[model samples]
Target: METGTTTSARYRRFADLEARGYSPLYDDWCTGISDDTELLAMLDTLPPARRQPVLFLGAVRFVGVPLEGFATFRSFVLARWPEIRQVMRTRTTQTNEAGRCAVLLPSLAAISAAEGRPLALIEVGASAGACLYPDRYAYRYSPGPALDPAGGSSVPALDCSTAGPVPFPQRLPDVVWRAGIDLNPLDARDGDDARWLEALVWPEHTFRLERLRAALGVVRSEPPLLVRGDLTEEIVPLVDRAPRDAVVVVFHSAVLAYVDAEGRNRFRETMLRFAAARDRPVHWLSHEGHGTLAGVDGAMERAPEELDGRFVLQHNGRTVARTGPHGQSIEWLP
Candidate 1:
């Protein structure tokens, strides 16, 4: 929760940009400023005329920080700046980039096997629920080995490489149910919400904004169940209601970094408890950085490596695989 002063300061900056009529090219301007060092460095690379708008957007976003941390700032931005909607929309598209999707196959396989039926996914930080539609789309690479029951394992290892584009299976999970949960759920059908999502995107990545618009067209027609609330509080109750025969899969990408340590623990415990109680299958998928917080200028700053690359797939309290950053490849052990 950021202070009102910080929120106001950020809004003012956004306002100044709007007044100047220098809208950003990309929607995920915040991410460009925050995550991608290359993009940040390139901000100065633009000519002075081009650089002003970019700088204004970044400065405004940076000022919006409630407590000088990425998570706090992101939350503040999402809650206060509805006009910045497109930024998030583009971010959703970039997040689902081809490379990242390739990395998710192993987890997909794990969920498929655990259900002993097919998979129905629940994404916590679904953004716009783009990745949830993996089954409906086509991928260019090949999937790894199928689950082997003879291995005396509840989950089988997927054999895949992490170097390049991996092939995804044409077969989608049965997908009896597909739902999403987010603190701020974006409804593509709602023009205002759609605009807010777009504002969340960085101005530098124009392609992502385009993808988001295209994705939104599809989502508007077939929207997933998206609930707005705290994930730690809402997950257990939701899982309890899931169909008994279907596997309960909970996944999040790049969202855990925003939650505090206590919140993270509570979310993990809640999911674990729910899975244990069901005596059925459960899968937890996450792509987030792990690390410790350090004190900087009397404020807590997370270590850079804290959020380094790692894709985790866990089932029934067991970790199936711990792979590199991109979800394209994995090293799974039964």
Candidate 2:
């Protein structure tokens, strides 16, 4: 478990780097909590994993706390620590941000084009499987062309800013099959599950909330198959179920941090085996916090200072780009 000092440092980091631009309300709250010794003591009592700002803030939001001001929020939290603690214990941060698909599109397109076959997508931590339908969402990458599916425009058009020689996808990948593995798979059609997802969205991001609603609508039309299990145990079975004619692409975003170091090592070994087996074309696409994946950091060739506060995008273990946590930007590297 993390000590009070470590928890406070995490909150400060979240305030300055993660929430500053995206959610001013959250930034202020985190900043305030970082300095409040009483709040830190309360937060430090939770499991180390639960001490993260996202889970804490999300728990409070889930409990219907008004997020208008830091003082009011803190007061409510202090008075109802037991209620919020229960929420923190029972709920995990399953941020199913469909906007991430915009960043994954290029990699998926490249793999499909190279293999000359449609993709069979297997998302490791697919909360409600909204991201499983990247083809169903339109794209508007700034300083570049807009892309829509063959059937025409779709709801929640994704907009991402690009830098470097980013290979803007000429067309969406033809996804033949999709499945997901999650410890607790959520149903987008369920009201409470859907509301929980909305609560996870940081306050002040109206655009993200709108995109999430649109994505939920898309998924409800046809939900992908989501298996309830651990990623390491469930992945192979799920991948084996894919069509042989299609290229299998195993991917995840902001998900591995929940897995312990040993679990991550096992997952890395599993993917390496799949890549080496080459029974068919299998690719692993990972978008995660810097250094979260083994060897991805060494592959970057960039200094640590250059990569601070960004998610590293890797395609089959090769560093490709640095991306915004919510898919707001992509700075291509490879």
Candidate 3:
């Protein structure tokens, strides 16, 4: 069978198990089986002596219907065994590449442009506001471009590639505010929230979790202004209150997938209304599924089909950079 088909079958099985109240076990297995290859390989290598213990643990973790509840656990496992087998048959790849890239580079460019200026950055699905700390870190560009903050005061070195070795000047924006909004704002300092954030990280991508931890350290002391509310309900009012002198950039990473079509439409409408009225520059940064955002009758409309696995760096609907899969590496485009 094709890999995609196998993946779908596994997903369905897990979904069914989850629906049938095997969440704990499902979660445990999900967490344990990070790499599909390794997980699939384990199925055949299970020693006879370890079989009962592994099965018992899986049952306890998933159903809370312990080994003592042998009949019930056996029935549940037997019923779902086919799907579980299928799950062990597939491989896992990084799925958040587009989203990660979409949010990172554009925001970095925006922040770089703002320099000394205070800009208000509002992120939808802020989810702990870890990405907001881009200014606090360093970046190494492959093509001899490097940025290291001097004095470690959040002022990054702007190293650009050019003919003459002239120092890249930092241009600071006159900013009056910086904040973020999310339906569920994660407090990195909060233990439970921190754990949830950790759980969301893909097991294969351990670096992401490390980066998240480092970002959290900087943000906890100087927390980004976060509002706990739905973007649809909160964004309009928040935009209305934004200071005119400061540049307003509304961004989201990996969030569009969770919102429905109607929600996206309303969000676009509200942003456009603000843009039209304010005359101040409003930037929308999105790392959503493939599709170009088109200007139609004074509003923006996203194409039904996405740009197909390309990471886009856009500003005011202009494409700045496009890369394959992940955004870790970037090439500048005119």
Candidate 4:
């Protein structure tokens, strides 16, 4: 595995990607970056956590998707090295995708019904806050009714198919107030920030771009309150601002993996403390990779293969279902 004295997570990530059927991008990078010492060195400049292949390529394509350069991955990347480095120094592969709303509404609806009131949303690693507007988006489910509002499709089209005992999410919860915290907060109103958010998407994904822009459009007139800081430290203060009448639900999707195990534990403990210190009902919904969440009672029994490389969606710290990495599809469990 070692042709040189240097080892990079970039290489390992590419290998993993190839196995997972994430084509062209993985093979292209693995072939190109492996041979180019300068490109590998530029990657070394990136923080260890941000050196994954997807982040690097996403940054490159953020400006434009590489099309003509497929013949030589090294040359294509080398040409953009300087610009990519400048962007990487500031950005953390941050994205504000709203597709997860399709999967999330089912849980949110149940929580809202139980609480008998509208829900307040507090999101961690929220990026540009598009996901903060899940209620504004429209959904089409396989075994479910059309989840559009009274009018036509309000936002972008979000479609998801569900299996098992997971019921169709017919009625959505009213999100009275919603806010988010991120390491580097992005504003959909800001040109550069919005462009960078779009850059985070792979070049082939026009549908995702449409969803992102649509979500941004929904919140443009009145964007959610996005605080810039660490999630573990910033969550409670934001929680304190929610309406007293609303049941606050703190949630995140595909976010905890970047957090170290200690940080993740701290986030959970802090939420537990916040919930216990009040009489109001508090909930945490997490949609993350299999091993990301620290302690869920029955979670350890499921192996990697059984989990199928999909993100696990949890409610109140319990495993409920496995979902596609980006929430494009879902499989419910009993």
TM-score: the better of candidates 1 and 4: 4
Per-candidate TM-score against the hidden true structure: 0.57, 0.92, 0.60, 0.89
Candidate 4 on 1-334: residue-level lDDT in tens?
A: 3333253544755655542355555565556566667777778766666666667766777656455444565666677777777777777777777888888888888888878888899989988787776677778887666777655555767888778777665666689898999898888899888888787776557788788887888767678888999998888788889999988989898899888877888887776676566677588888988877646334334664865678888876677888987878888889
lDDT head-to-head 1 vs 3, winner: 1
Q: Candidate 3: where are CA atoms >4 Å away?
A: 1-117, 153-176, 291-308, 323-326
TM-score of 1: 0.57
lDDT of 4: 0.75
lDDT of 1 by residue, 25-134 (tens): 22234433334343334433333333343334543343343324345545555465443333322322213322244456545754676456776678787776765654
In order, candidate lDDTs are 0.52, 0.87, 0.50, 0.75
Q: Return the clash pairs for model 2, or none.
A: none
Error of 2 at 172 (Å): 1.4
Write the residue-wise lDDT of candidate 3 on 1-334 in tens digits: 2343343344345535432252444444433332345333444343332222224233332332332333454455456654433322321111222224222543545554754345667777777776565455555444544554444533222222222222223422333565777776778788756654544444445566566566567668788788988888998777667776566777776565556667777777766565466556577766543443332233334443434455555555455554433345444554
Locate the minimum summed-lDDT window of 10 residues in model 2.
293-302
RMSD of 3: 11.1
The per-prediction CA RMSD against the true structure, in angstroms, equals 12.1, 2.2, 11.1, 2.8
lDDT of 3 at 204: 40
Model 2: per-residue lDDT, tens digit, 45-99?
8889778788899889888898788999889998889999998888888999999
